[model samples]
Target: MTAPEDLALYVHWPFCVSKCPYCDFNSHVRAEVDQAAWRDALLADLRHEVALLPGRRLRSVFFGGGTPSLMPPATVAAVLDAAVAAWTPAGDLEVTLEANPSSVEAARFADLARVGVNRVSLGMQSLDDDALRFLGRAHDAREGLAALDVAQRVFPRVSFDLIYALPGQAMRAWKAELARALAFGTEHLSLYQLTIEPGTRFATEAAAGRIVIPDGDTAADLFELTRAMTAAAGLPAYETSNHARPGAESRHNLAYWRYRDYAGIGPGAHGRRGRLATTRRRKPENWLTAVSRNGHGIEREDPLDPHTRAVEALLMGLRLTEGIDLDRIARLAGGEAPVDSRAVALLERQGLLARNGAHLRVTDAGALLLDGILGAVVRAQTAVAV
Candidate 1:
């Protein structure tokens, strides 16, 4: 039998050049940063994690953040070097860095690649100038494309994000823009619908009637069109918001969806290893202070009960096209099957879920209403188990 997949590493860089109005990620903008001190702190934080979860290979390393592209290549290299030294790296270990499509950040692509970043995910939120302006992005369509060009040339694997269902966006306009984006020939795409998240500028605008997003019917149409177009382009939806060609999926993300162990290092990063869930301090200064005092900037580290792990595993795994392993869910739940058989039967009859041998999956229709389905199923299962 094949050995279990190794742990994954997530290195968070919490600094950004500018904060987007809609972003709620643990990102902050600072006029001045001490690059050396930040680098040392990240390395120190990573070492603390290594000591806790020893004797495992690393399957992937993802550099995510406020804007990881803004990170100096030297900082990235040091972290990668430290990780490899800490654990044996898989032969095809995927190292992905999240970047913004700005000209200055794009200029660092070559240097980043040279230092062992094999994949890059660009935040090219929209291909339209107006959309970029409305979304508060620094790069325009032309500049974004230029950055994408540079990324594609420098990295062996490339993925970019695009936001759809923008305020006042029409179906025809979105379809045309998506087509333009797909023509770039990148193997992976993360397409997200714009939601007025709580505490965001968009939320305030939407609440005040200053911004109007697509209605439910229009948003559904856009979602359907996205699936059809990307499938036609050979990049089918692998997750709710992510599409990729066969064999070109993001491995780092797969680790999360598949419920595998990964270490999250840096401010506001969350991670799971074995049964422990860890969260780091959210602010940069606070994280640095904690790391200096405790050797790791962890804010909380809690041991997850079996039921919680099972629920979380089911929630994450069902988001994938391949679905979850029922056997693994059972193991996580301490030998009790995690799904309510009656609910599964009902949902399967409704064509929202499917059971094929050992796997339980959400059908395409179910994916659109995944949150509701999960809530119902989890409630039913918990009730039955209790």
Candidate 2:
């Protein structure tokens, strides 16, 4: 069990050079950004979070963004310095920064590494030039690879992401791409199936019949192939979309999936701290203004009830291959069982779920239909409990 004193920090950098067509994250494109103002505002925001959650041992700090690579290394350093001052850092504190594969950002890798960023998650959306263009990535395949090489050289741990099951993507091409990615010998990879998020350009295109992703059967086949190939490469699927060799799973992400406390700072960041859910102002200027006025930019702070927290914990924890601890879920639900025992027995009978003492896990086949499975189990439990 994770101790309550263990916490994670997530810092959001909301500006981007260009917004991807498929992205619905709170990211923005701006002609000019006042880096100095942003730096001060972010530091102030972090201090406010520190005051709220005092005496925690920070396990990890993740610099995520519209494009965190665009942030000046000094700003990154300042934030890290503040965090160190505010809380005790774990002996192996994992500081990860997300970067784009653009040459400009790649050039800053060494400086970023110098400033205590030990891990880099590069946004190499695709390795194929055509797919890169379709994904609205600024870097070509060659440039992306070059940036990846730079990241691997500078950062102690490097993870790159690729989007698959894209419109018109052939299974053979995807397999070849996966092979190429694995050949890089990086410890971690995040392979996501393309989804047309609502309100994004991709969603609009899909709704208008301008785009078509792989059908369900074909997508499932691609997913299975990805799992098989990654496993063969010794980087098994630790989470649904993330693959890592043993002991290489993302610590910051794991903190979230394990339903631990984390402090979120900066525009558009969402965080869970105890029973409270915190969110910051979504717009850059609005966030800055709020920070200047209130010492933090948080736009909403809602307390989650026990049942809601348990449900959320279950949803996130079940995504992992290791699955959830049923005892922990029950505790979160105020000593009530989090799932129906009969439902678990039925699912285990159906080969969709398995139990290893107190740990409850979704089978590989059940993971493909995770939403429906979770709904059924939760409904069954709630119905009987009520």
> Clash totals for all models, in order?
0, 0
Query: How much lDDT does each candidate structure score?
Result: 0.92, 0.92
lDDT by residue (tens digit), candidate 2, 1-386: 56539999999999899999999998999999988999999999999999989989999999999999999999999999999889999999999999999899999999999999999999998999999989998999999999999998999999999999998899999999999999999999999999989999999999999999999999999999999999999999989999999999999999999999999999999999898999999999999999999999999999997888888888899889999998898788876656777878898999989899889999888778777878767733454242
Against the hidden reference, what TM-scores do the models get?
0.97, 0.97
**Tens-digit lDDT track for model 1 on 1-386?**
55645899999999888888888889999999899999999999999999988888899999999999999999999999999998989999999999999899999999999999999999999998998999999999999999999998999999999999998898999999999989999999999999888888888988999999989889989999999999999999999999999999999999999999999999999999899999999999999999999999999999998888988999999999899998998889886656777888899999999999878999988888888888767743445354
TM-score of model number 2: 0.97
Task: Give the per-residue Cα lDDT of candidate 2 at 182.
Answer: 99
Prediction 2 global C-alpha lDDT: 0.92
Error of 1 at 91 (Å): 0.6
lDDT, residue 83, candidate 1: 98
Model 1 spans > 4 angstroms off: 1-5, 380-386
